[model samples]
Each structure stands twice: as C-alpha cells, then as structure tokens.
Target: MSKSGNPTLIIASFFSIYVIWGSTYLLNKIAVTELPPFMLASIRFTTAGVLIFILAKFLGINLAISRKQFLNTVIAGFLFLTFGNGVVVWALRYVDSGFAALEISAQPLIVLLLMRILQGKKIKLMSMIGVILGIIGVYLLVSQKAIINQENSIAGMIMIFMCMLSWAYGSLFVSKADLPSNYFVNTGYQMVTGGILLLLTSFIFGETWTSPMVWSTPVQYTMILLIVFGSIVAFTSFNYLLKVVSPEKVATSTYVNPIIALTLGWYFLNENITVQSMIAAVVLLTGVYFINTKKKLLIFSRFSGRLSKKLK
Candidate 1:
C-alpha cells in the first residue's frame, strides 16, 4: 500500500470501531432480556475467548506466557472485561440502552482522570475543561428524569463510570506489562482469563441458563454474534487502527459510540430518542473531542505534552 493509503486505512478502521461498538449497548440490552445479566456476559466473553483462541492458533499464534505475564493477563481480564464491560451489562437491566451508552461514554474522562491520579501524570488544561463539559453533559442527560422520577439512576451511571476506570487501568497494564508481542495471542489470553472469571462469578451468583428453544431466541444469537463480531472482530480491528492511525482519529470512536447505541436502541427496541437526548449527545461529543484533541488547544498542550506522550 502507498503511504497515503495508511491514513485512509486508519480512518476506515476507526469508523468501523466507532459504529460497531456503538451498537453493542443495544445488543447487551437485547441479550440480557433472555439471559441473566452475569451469565449473559459470561457466555459472551467465553465464546469470544474460545473463538479468538482458535483463530489465533490456526494462524500459528503462540499462546504461551511467562508466569508473571500470565498473572498480569488474568488480572487485566478481571479489571477490563470483568469490571468494565461486566458492570455495563449488569446495569442494562436497570437503564435504557441509550442511557447505558451515555453513562459509559464518560469513559474518556474517567481514563483521563485515573491516569493523572494513579500514574502521577498531569492532564492538559483543555482536557480537564473537556472532562468538566462532558460531566455537565451527563448531568443534563439525566437531570429531567431525575427531577421527574426522583430516582437515583446515578448509582447505575456511577457503575458504568467505574467500568471506564477499570478498563483504562487494564489498558495501562497491557501497555506496561511484559507480554508476548503477538497482539492476538495476548488478547486471547485476556479473553479466556476474563471469560472464565465471569463464568465462575455467574455460578456463584446463581445465574441460570436456558435452552435455545425460547421466544427470545434472538437474545442467545445476539450474544453469540456480539462475542464473535463485537468482541473479536471490532476489538481486534481497533488495535489495528491504533497501530496505523493518529490517536485523535482513533479516539473519535469514543464520540461515535453513543450515536450508534442510540440508533440501534431505537431500531430494535422501539425506544424513544428525545430532543434533550440529542442535546446531551452533542455536549458529550463536543466534550470528548475537546478532551481527546487537546493538542489543538495549543498552550495547554505544551504544558501537558510530556504526560500526553506517556499515556498515548
């Protein structure tokens, strides 16, 4: 491929990640209807883990790891998939898919803050401003419902936010840990470890499984497709994009996911998308763009460039 093709590939890969992942929130909502929350998440990761491992094996990918690396990978799985995505799946029971997406979309902000506090890195002022704006946007999204219903969907939202932090931590671990060079191999390990842990937790929590012969048959198939396409294909392609694309472009996926989730929720579940929700989306996207593209903010970028370089 020509050098020029590289950017195009990156852009395309990013679009894929954004659009595909955005839809997963609705997928979770649908899948959870037929499957118990924990079991549903457990099955999705396990299937993805098994499939990815088989594919990696077929492609001559190595799965072996040092004792330290193995432990790190397992711990990573617990943090990332277990705590991050697992909580989102768990919360879908209590929130709309669109709402669930908006809540979890707080991820970039959480990641930014976590990196600063945990890693002793400084956040760019513009990024900090962006986080503030994004938080405000989230507040707007739920403000009316909060006032009208007097319910604390705040707890559910906080769970998803924590999901973001755990995911960020797991990602940091992946970057810093001593693991095999092959990305697929490492991912397979993480998936297997994470999936098994989720399964064990499901058992401990008494999650029951049902046969395929159910009216909500789509849920089972949805979970399968989600694991196969969403977890495996979308995520692996995301890694490919990060390798080839500018971080700014890849980060755009964070903004795009809410749109995808909202549209999918509308189509599949007959969910309503209100004007206020659209406003919330705009605010969230703007905030995320600001946070992720702090380089464009000039002075703040200069101050935080060293820290940015380390996180990236």
Candidate 2:
C-alpha cells in the first residue's frame, strides 16, 4: 500500500473497525455474563479515555478546547457510547449477540434517513427502497418466535433498535460539531465524559455490580480485551477514519460486523440463527448495501429511479 497520505493507515483503520469492533459484540456478550452492562462500558471507556488523554499529552497533542466543544464532544459520547452502546449491553441479557448484530447493521440505513432529515440531503428512490427493505427484514427477524427468547425478546428488540437510533443520531451530530483538532484528544474527552455518565447511571440503577476479582476468569479476560482492543485500539482507528474518509465509507463496517458477530456467536456462543434470522440478515444487509452505495450496484439498485428514468 502506498504511504501517500497514509492509505495503509486508512485501510488498517477500516479493518480494525470491521474485525475488532465486530468481535467486540461477542466479547461484550461474554463480559456481561458476569458484569453489569453499564459498569462493563464504564470500565472500558474510563480506562481507554484516561489512557488516550495521557498518550495525547505525551505525544504533544494539544488538549486545549472551548467550553462549547467540550460539551459537544461529551454529549456526543453520551449519546453514542452511553445510550447507544450501553443499551445494547443491557439488551444482550435477552438477545443473542448475532441478533443484536443484525439490528445494529441497520445503522447505515438509519444514518441515511437522518442525513435526509437533518442535513436536507436528497435520498435517491432506490435508497428509500433499501431503507424499506431493511425495516421489513428487521421486523421479520424480531417477530419470528423463538423458545429461548420467550417474552424478553420483545423488550430486547426494542432496546437494540434504540441503540441503532441513538448511534445514528450521534454520528450525524458529531459530524457537525466542532471538537479538538486532534481526533485522539477529542475522543478522549468524549470517552471520559461518557464513562462517568455510565458509572453514575450504574449507581442510580443499583445494577448489583460485582468487583472484577470476584468475576470469573473468562469475564476478567473479556473485560481486559475490551479495554485494550475494543475501546482503545478500535476507537482510535474509528476516530482517525472519521477524520480521513467519507462517513459513508466508514459506515460500511456496520455491514461487516453483523456477519462477524453472527459467525462468532454460532461458533463460540452457540447462538441459534433461525431461518428467519438468516433471511433477515440477508435482506437487512442487502438493503444496507444499497443505501451505502451509489446508483450503480448489484441488480435491483442498478435500476434506482434515476437510472430507470435515464434508460426510459
């Protein structure tokens, strides 16, 4: 890879988002088995946040910022990490990581619609079709009856949808916000603020949190892995990506993650992927693909309104 403009870094960043973040879903699923959802996230963010800040200062990355920027970054963190990621942790108690992955894959579709609403971007007709298909897929996936889920699945589905929604909104808002010129320094503040909020929420909710030493060995390892790889490494890569690449390009990771999660969940966690889930995954992912790509793509999307009209 040419080092011109650090293309390698970009590719590596994308890979990190795809593989590392993808795996985090399963990692989180495992961690929450013994750890409370809020606290699990608190630990990951707080540790990662502090480390990022220290590294930034050590590297001579300036941390100075206006009050407005600080508030915006932290608020974005609260929305994305706290409400978005935090809720997914809670939902895992009822939902399988694979199922949650499928739901989270809808992030691109949600972001597309949010951009149309928030930024006045004109969405193509085929993109609308894509969005509609994604909705149907998610509905089918969630509505299909499963013995393991019982009734909590309904609440689980709702919470995961909220996670997607919160994450989508955060992405949109963060793009528009002015933060530190250095992405690492800016992200550090967000993580710290978000982690603090999560800790406070854990306290308020009385989550029956346990000390890490008391947790099982597996949980301990998972927590450690999340802090190091998932939060610090993947998040730094993601922040770098946001600064360099088109948001649409970065969003492609959403498509990849669910597949990784589904495969890992089946292989390691033995989570069931029903016929409905498989079909849902295909439909949902295909729709998301269309939403991200231009008018020229696999069959159906190739004839998106503009192209069809041009042909006619």
Per-candidate TM equals 0.85, 0.91
lDDT of 1 by residue, 209-285 (tens): 77656637677678777888788877666655534443334556777788788888888898778788778878877
User: Which pairs clash (backbone N, Cα, C closer than 3 Å) in model 2?
Assistant: none
lDDT of 2 by residue, 1-312 (tens): 111237898888889999999999899999888788999999889888999889988999888899999989888889878888888999998888988888888888888888888889999867887899999887888777673347587888888888888877877676667777677887788889989999998998898877778989988889888988898888878767766765666778988899999999999999988988899988998888778776445565555666889989
Candidate 2 Cα deviation (angstroms), residue 98: 0.5
User: Given candidate 1, what's the lDDT at residue 80?
Assistant: 69
